[model samples]
Target: MKFNRQKREEIITSKKKETWGQEIKRNWQLYLMLALPFIYIVVFKYYPMVGAQIAFRKYVPAFGIWGSKWVGLYQFERMFSHPIFWKALKNTITLSTYTLLLSIPIPIVLAICFEYARGKFFRKSVQMSAFLPHFLSTVILVSLINLLFDNRTGVFIHIIQNIFGAKVNVLGDAKFFRHLYVWSGIWQGAGWSSILYISALSGVDTQIHEAAIIDGANKWRRIWHIDLPSIRPTIAIMTIMSMGSILSVGFDKTYMMQNPINYDYSEVLATLEFSMGTAGSVPDYSFAAAIGLAVSVVSFVMVMITNKISKTLSDNSLW
Candidate 1:
């Protein structure tokens, strides 16, 4: 029995090696195809991690990354104490929250509405129009927004003033910046975002809908009882992911939208990091790195917390 067991173990080890060798030999081209992406990730994503230590060091160009003196958490301590840092943190959270409220639900609602639309041509046209904005470059989108909301010459303001006889500077006001940013983003992304939920909706059983209809269910009833429940898992997953990034408002559009007047409301972590890292005569790379690391840590913690809550409340989570 011992001799047979030892022989079986040897045979299993040899077979495992043989199977691995055969797999490599047979799928050489497929492995080669994967190599490009592997190399790209290693170079662009993983390699940069080595530089993250700059957050702890007083990075100087003359001394290089390795030669820089370590300051431990001095940069983070300074960041936490700075008033502008707090302002940036607050604006980031507020804008992201506004964005979450405005942007996430509209897509789901639009997708459901589209599912109920009877006119194929109208639905297709509306979908096309909604999707076209998503393809627009950031520069063009910001430019178009500026043109539409220009206090002195905008067509929208012109119509409003001519009709009501009151001039309003929507673009210049800090209060209106978040509204414009969030709503415009919703308009651009709603249709594209709806594609996923619509796909989920399509998978819902038509037989269930037929049964509900036979039982005297109305359109709203079917939507409420059938459609919404069918897509609740998708909504939960999307919500969790969005909550995870509650602080990472994009820099390009926000930066472009920012002016001296709206800086207080529009300033966020990304823009603040850019300002700290390179905007002044003397760049503080360590300080910027500390802020960036803080944002990442906070985002990660949010994901973990949200995932835990989602699992406890609804039994749905990314993990």
Candidate 2:
């Protein structure tokens, strides 16, 4: 068109700005959709972070958040020196590790099994049955466990007594607490947790399987090569998420299942925090806050490290 250089540049800039304006208009709904979650994070998660300062202070309820006296890391120092804090930390770590070891692979295995099931009916039934426990309230679940394992007259105890003539107290013994807690957690959650993996697996292309079949690939070969690859990223992401929660062993289950005899093994950070906050004549808010902060920091670091390792090993990372 033999336009002047200045005029040409102006037209190009105008066109680029128009394109950007159109993009903003097109994606405006997405930004709007994200607004609520953004607000929620700020309101619920980030906002409460201001209270983390109490971890380093002699947090006085009367003085309020800002008016509280700062003790620097004195609370943290006390937490480190406290034997019960170490015990709770050790117990928390032990139980979390046990639960993770028992629970993390379960959903993957269940997903694979369900994927390979012979019929839709069987798969659906299995999935429904497995997922049903997750619907139960923790109180109800604990009640059911107690009913089934009641030392004198419970079903499991009866069976053990009949077979081995040994009356085992499942809830009363320190040794059995971790096993019972972790295994029950796995049983309650594994099936429901598999739902995500199953959904991810469902998204895998059927055409890939058809191609593998045409190439005379066996069922195992197709699954090993195709199915696993399809869900690898999902597994990686879930594993990273799971690592982040390794210190957050559920308080309800442990607290409900615990008794005086089993308290040594069953005490975890959450339970300790609860007891420290509520059991005494006066609540030790600062101490509890310090412990909570420590747990959160450790969990966050673990997740970051796990995500880094996953990124290094695979092509996927949560970041």
Candidate 3:
């Protein structure tokens, strides 16, 4: 009787194991669902990476990508030697740093505050207003910015000029570029970004909150010990993801906001590459490719380093 039971258990265990092909056949619907996105990524995303080899070549329109002369690191050398490269790098880093400082904390705070909002009506109304801006196209948003911050006819400038007897060209002034960029970004993104933290907060145990309340813990104390910690992992993951794009600040917005006066502060890597590739007398694809590749490399390194630090410090990371 013991031998017969052992044989039966062995047969069940063997039957439970599945090969890769067998699993796919068994759950064909799930694999079918995944196929569309997999093909889209390969075709639209990975396939284009093949052209990145142009960074090493002196691409000529007549010669084509493959027939172009392999100039090796010459494009990189030229890009680094150009004064605009360093200028753009400095502006990009400064702008992105300001954005990171505000973008990371503001959403978290917004989420926390809204979670404990006193009234559902007020909370939903304010959240909808905040989120509406995010749906606006970059061009429309920039156009609105230009209208509102115009040096002469702008509503804001008119108010300031009347109140202080001084004119402020918010868009034209290089000094105000970072301020406008970061603040506008907060306005557009904060509400939408807060949704992740809100989701995290929802999963926190209600029983624990009840116990904390019974023990005489105040709202602030409960939040400090409970809500904040509950969303800490989500915050860490978001930070790691943000680091991946730290160097690639929004191209369309930055380019649109730029004017001759503010070019010094607004010329980020994306715009720089764009101008190099298209704005010049003859498009320098190789140089532009080199700049983009460098930005990508640095951003990737930053992400890895941030993930390592987060893993070490809080045991929460993207990995």
Candidate 4:
């Protein structure tokens, strides 16, 4: 069969194009599945990003985002010189660090306990009780805390005075604010967070455990060798993600719990931003934006650094 070279090449290219088109058509449902998420991202995420320009502008509500006067890095410069900004930044870091240290390991420990629980009913009940607080609104949680720890006629104070003839002001003190916030966060979130680890643990191969048992490995040995190895990837991934989000401590709870007495210790970037938004004769849009941008940039850098470290150390990373 004699074939023209140019015609053969054209035919080959045409066949490739048809194959590609058919593959796309076959996966049309997948494309459709992504449509809603794509639309959501475009509408809620990307669309709002247009206003990020306000970070660079002296935003005026009357003039709108585009009409605002450009102020360059004037806000950023001012932020660097502001003492309150540094204080807020430091507070944010300290709170985040405390929360990370206290909160991250708790879910893992809970997952291990739940996995080892003798009775399914007991385990489920415990899990349900533990997870209940996570569903509570920050306002409700704070109110509950306040009620329990109120300096006057509080349940905790009453118990302390009755049992030990001592009165302790739990909420009014600055020293206890971070502890309260972090411990409450842990209590609320640990069980919910353990759900992922529990799922990962469930997916671990039972055959491996059986094999370890056959080898006469003890329970702790089996867990250390088989279970730990199986879940290490999940742990690494969660650790990296947790580290990346270390700066993003619970803003709602912190803001709600903060009072003038505890402001010295409790004031974080989010609360500072809130104060900046509501303070003065007019809104300090530039200052707020600068503060926000600085936070976002730091968070991004932290995530990148965490990912890099995770990749280097464990060969597991978000990227």
Which residue pairs in candidate 3 have backbone atoms (N, alpha carbon, C) closer than 3 angstroms, thus clashing?
Answer: none
Model 3 lDDT-worst window of ten: 14-23
Candidates in descending lDDT order: 3, 1, 2, 4
On a 0 to 1 TM-score scale, where does candidate 1 land against the true structure?
0.90
Per-residue CA lDDT of candidate 3, range 137-221, in tens? Answer: 8888888888999887889999999899999777777788888888888888899999999899989999999999999999999
Q: Which digits, one per residue and each the tens of the lDDT, describe model 4 over residues 1-319?
A: 3568888998789777787678679788998999999999999988766777788888888998899899898878888888887888888889899888876778877988888888999999998998898899999989988999999968988998889898888887889998888888888888899988899888988898899889999988977887777887788788777775555667788889988989898888887777787788898876786777777777888878878887898888887
Best prediction by lDDT: 3
The total of clashing pairs for model 1 equals 0
On TM-score, the candidate that comes out on top is 1
lDDT of 1: 0.89
Candidate 2 stretches with Cα past 4 Å from truth are 1-40
Model 3 residue 252 lDDT score = 91
Q: RMSDs, each prediction?
A: 5.2, 5.1, 3.8, 5.6
Q: Candidate 3, overall lDDT?
A: 0.90
TM-score of 4: 0.87
Give residue 224's error in model 2 in angstroms. 1.8
**Model-by-model lDDT, in order?**
0.89, 0.88, 0.90, 0.83
Per model, how many backbone clashes are there?
0, 0, 0, 0
Off by over 4 Å in 4: 1-15, 19-37
TM-score (all chains, Cα) for each model: 0.90, 0.87, 0.89, 0.87
Model 2, 100-160: lDDT tens digits are: 8877789998998999899999889999999999999999988988889988768999999
